[model samples]
Target: MKYLGIILSAIGLMIIINSCSKSWTDYSALQVQNLNQDSNTALNNKTYQTYLANLRSYKSSKHSIVMGWIEWGDKTSTANSTLNDLPDSLDFISILNPSNTLSDEKKQDLSSVQKNKGTKVLYNLNLQNWDDSLYSTFNKIGYLLNVDSAFQSQLDSVILAINSLGYDGVDVNVEGMNCSSCGSFFYTYQTGYYNRILDTLGKLYGPHSNTEKFLLVEGATTASLLSGTESYFNYYIANTNDYSWYYQVDNAYATIAQIPGFTNDKLIITTDFNDKSVSADISDKLWQYGGIPFYTNGSGTPIPSSTALLNWNPTSGLKGGMGIFYINYDYFNNDFTITKNIIKTLNPSGE
Candidate 1:
């Protein structure tokens, strides 16, 4: 009986040992799985970092640049309304209606794109926003220089606002410069005053400036108006929404290119997405001039005057770049379909 009892005790000890051994084996397998997962995560992070670096290098290169004018909707609840949702490949984005009162979430979205995507954020400085009634006369941006009691107080406020808000630069709307009733004398005077304001902004944000920021001008009736101040701007975005023919676009580009400091590299030809009927054939023409083409169509299929802009490019050398106005609108359809197509067309992933 004592020998049998000892045998039972030995069997119980063996069972306990085997159970512990199984548990340890299971734990070891779990540890191996965790290690594999960690390794995969590390590798993925490295690949993404490399991709970001490559994208930044591409932006800094001499390739054509893609720019857009996006509405600043503080809420990210919508699909493509927020800055965070924009394509990572965009080189520059002009924030429409950017105010000092941006939410923390909005500010974070802006900073994230700038730091991670190497996209430069610019605030729109539409002179009409100051006072729409003054748009017809020299009392618009010119008001900032000549008429206002506080000399350049308005311009100073804008400079201060952009700096404090962490914007990369400004897109000055140079529309309303032409005044038929004001006569050529006042017009010339207003032009000088306008150029003065531009010079002020340029010293800090222009191409030759010490900082990396950009100063851009859009909405000029004639590129000739920009003659003396051409050097102050990084690019002259020819707002050609009113133009129906390719010749008009050509004329605009030719005029801007004629400016002393302006070159094909500094010109961006734009088409309004709001006008779906507008033909984008000018994109092909822009390629001939080495100018970047900006179109707003995203229908995916290439109709005669449609998003066909994405299907073609200069065969020999790289054309400047492309852009889209109201880029957020394209997001509503298929998540920036036209913008993505153009970017991929210009800078293919294979290259």
Candidate 2:
């Protein structure tokens, strides 16, 4: 009897030890998947709304960051309305090429041109041709992948204008050019001709203080730039291939690794205005993969709050992060109530 009691006590002690060991060892990391290849599970619109409401109800201490792209020649009326009505929580807005969707008559507002003369405006210049005559004197443009003397001269002028306008730094969004020919574009941007332009502009723009310029670049994926790590630039990653921009299920893991150096601030993933139709599981997967949502508020229009973000629920609310539509406001503001519900549900701070 005594021997049996002793054996029973020993067994109980062993069981307790094993249980404690297992609990400690389970501290493994989260398993992330690709965004593109993953099957998108259809989202319940109601649930999405609920999610948004939950976030609003919880009212977490964190504030929602909102960023939009305003084109040069767009219809300013609607955009102006939204801008005037945008919640105070909204962050900053980026002004891309004004002519992205503006009409001949509306394009002449020159308000955009005046903008160049004042505040820090971000420019996105696509260089399919080397004609510097097409651009305005007060604009900030990001040169596309093509390189030439005309492009260099145009860029130099942009720097001068930055000084003349008393503005901030610039970003480069180049693509579609061969690896061999990238040197000029890089030289002009990677602190050579570009740096000289900036330095000269800074001297005039700021005799009182040091003016800092940031280097930003955009690419579809890490594979978008095949020149290996040597070809990488700073701040901007234009993942055109990404489905949701951030929650990429297809090659999401591989794509993230492809960028030689990716910091959250330096990366921007491309999402669509119509991404609400994408399933929640896929959306959640993207969040897990560290994909940031982005939209191009279609054509020279203000982004409609509804289309930019979708249904919101507690476990998973924010449908999109930053809005970058296709130079049109139609998609953004089309369904205002829906958009408002989506925004308020996900980020009540907007309310």
Clash number for every model?
Answer: 1, 49
lDDT of 1 by residue, 29-65 (tens): 1122122225454224543445456556667766667
Model 1 Cα RMSD, 1 decimal: 16.4
Q: Provide the overall lDDT of each model, using Cα atoms, as 2-decimal numbers.
A: 0.58, 0.34
TM-scores for every predicted model: 0.70, 0.41
Cα shift from native, residue 155, model 1 (Å): 0.9
Per-residue CA lDDT of candidate 2, range 49-164, in tens? 23223333332234333333444443333433222222212233344542223344332333322221121234444332322342222123444433335555776666665444
Off by over 4 Å in 1: 1-44, 131-146, 178-188, 275-319, 349-351
Which candidate achieves the best TM-score against the true structure? 1
lDDT of 1 at 102: 72
Model 2, TM vs. native:
0.41
